[model samples]
Target: MVDRTPCASTTAFAQMAGLDSKTPHPTSIVVHRQSRVLEIEFDQGSAFRLPFELLRVYSPSAEVRGHGPGQEVLQIGKRGVDIVALEPVGNYAVQPRFSDGHATGLYSWDYLYWLGVNQETLWNDYLKRLEAAGASRE
Candidate 1:
């Protein structure tokens, strides 16, 4: 089963992140566990359904992103990962506790928006990287 908990409001999150008026904010967020996708609607008239695997592999936590450039750790075996919980972090971000026990990533509003906007490119890139590294998303 999945917990479709409510995330923080984009308006409040953007304000906490010190973003300007032109920035797009999330109007709604829905986690569809059956499909393993996160559907998000932006206030700027845009919407995206991001996959759970995408979010897991691209997590911005230090464990995944590493301490700096050239130190990223590739994620694997996350195709079946699920979000066990989603908690708000102040008003700027949300912390998701993935079933894999990864809970360190604090996905900020800006980062989430970026992920939604560039999901295709990012997905392609991730696939290429995995292939090059002789890895698999399974």
Candidate 2:
């Protein structure tokens, strides 16, 4: 069942626009715990299988994103992070509680689509950042 919880005011605008025309809605969302992948099929016929690690590293929470540009916190050692719970946030997003106790990210349809489309670039950039910082994904 889709949860109807009201979104925080900060995300209310996105929720309203999320239902607008051309905004693709998810037809299915499945968590493959064994594979540590989140499989999502959108109504627009696009599908993506995003790795748990990628999701955790790219979480949209304040902790990860910070309050302003260039303030993004680089996430490391999240290679093993997995979603323990996934809950709906109104009709707009899904909040995932990760095994590492990270549950603040709100994965919106638009953001998910963007991630799917840019997964390669994002992953590559993340790796580059890690290497530059001498950080390990472990």
Candidate 3:
């Protein structure tokens, strides 16, 4: 198996990819809890708003998922979660410390962008599955 541990080389690669593997200079991050959206604004006026449900379901924590493929844990009861903090992870990603104490996920820029782009489809699919399972984000 390939080592997924973060190392010097990986750090370097993450930095080179414009992922800010260390610290990213974001002007602001706004969270609309009611709308379930988190907005990130950079110094260059480029910004994106991501859905809370999507972020929660795709959290990068072992509690939500294992370290390898096909180990993802289905998250539930996080529809109204909010972003409590945004901590920088070196210069590659941002550790979105959620109010639920889910601070282990390091959301890289690419991942965040992907989440924004696919929010609707992902959220809908999640909701559909939840409905099929008779589950709700409680």
Candidate with top lDDT is: 2
lDDT of 1 by residue, 46-79 (tens): 8999898899999989999999999999897888
Residue clash pairs of candidate 1: none
Q: Estimate each model's TM-score.
A: 0.84, 0.88, 0.69
Tens digits of per-residue lDDT for model 3, 1-138:
997889998777666444663334467767686776889776655677887768888886677778678886777788768887777776546787777778888776666656666777878888887888888888
- Using lDDT as the measure, name the better of candidate 1 and candidate 2: 2
Better of 1 and 3 by TM-score: 1
Query: Once model 2 is optimally superposed onto the true structure by TM-score, how far is the C-alpha of residue 137 displaced, in angstroms?
Result: 0.4
Best by TM-score: 2
Report the CA-based lDDT of candidate 2 relative to the real structure: 0.91
Model 2 Cα lDDT, one tens digit per residue, 13-37: 6654365457798999999999999
> Measured by TM-score, how close is model 2 to the native structure?
0.88
Q: Which residue segments of model 2 deviate by more than 4 Å?
A: 1-12, 15-17
Better of 2 and 3 by TM-score: 2
The stretch of ten residues in a row with the least summed lDDT in candidate 1 is: 11-20
